[model samples]
Target: MMTIRRRKTRKRRSPQKKRSRRRRSTKRGSQVKRRRRQAMTHRKKRRVKRRKKEIQTRRKRTLKEKVKLLVINLKMILLLKLKKELRVPQKTRQLQKNQPQKSQQLKNLPLLSQLPKNLPLKQTRFQQQKLRPTKSKPLFLLAKPRPQHRLQPQ
Candidate 1:
């Protein structure tokens, strides 16, 4: 007769797994280790969140800088085109000399610059009195609010 041997499966007592960094003194120590691992994971998550925010702000600033550079390039090109159009300043200045100057027109009529003292000047006391209203009563609008008619059910 052949003897059939039964195999009993048992948990391994040796600490070799990734989560085996614990002393076998008490359960509280194990809980402390778990809490530490949780805190480390949370800290890493917060750091990742901060890094994402920094990346977003950097992207926005880069976009704004790109727009500013494009605007500057456009302004430079337009300035170059304008410089080419106004290549000769001397001829334009000579043409402008032909037009009558505003100061030259005013120079012919000297009477307009200085006024004669014969014009009537208001007295300062009367002018000051007219500026302020002496009436204590409040002035109101002439228009009065019309009475509203009652809505009738036809």
Candidate 2:
């Protein structure tokens, strides 16, 4: 009666099945490790690229700054040369002003002056020539000729 009342038994798993399950778990762990390694390599490559870009940018900026400095230096040199030219003329004018009274009087004389301020008191050679009229025949006649093709069509 005890045997008749016994519950149905279930089969036990084999050692080979347990071993295969363990192998599958290890394979999955190795796959996870491979993925982690791939991610690390990708990150390293990106970092190297970013660093190279940063270096390139720095080089370009430095080159631009050098060019700008060169232009500024050139401008400063030009300005210095212009200032020297202007100063020489100013100094010459000052030296002329410092001369004695006799030279100043000579410079102020009407006949000796290179620049004229107003109309002359006496008639010049040009004015005398203009005032005298010459007796000569006219070079051209005041007349127009009729066009030969005036009646032609356009």
Q: lDDT winner among the candidates?
A: 2
Per-candidate Cα lDDT values, in order, are 0.67, 0.68
Q: Output the TM-score of candidate 1.
A: 0.40
Poorly placed runs, candidate 1 (over 4 Å): 1-26, 88-154
RMSD of each: 19.6, 22.9
lDDT of 1 by residue, 1-154 (tens): 9989888897667656636765667689779999999999999999999999999999999999999999999999999989977895888878878978967854654362243333323436864454443344211111122333422344
Checking candidate 1 for backbone clashes, the offending pairs are none
| Deviation of model 1 at 19, angstroms | 19
Instruction: For each candidate, give its TM-score against the true structure.
Output: 0.40, 0.43
Output the number of the TM-score-best candidate.
Answer: 2
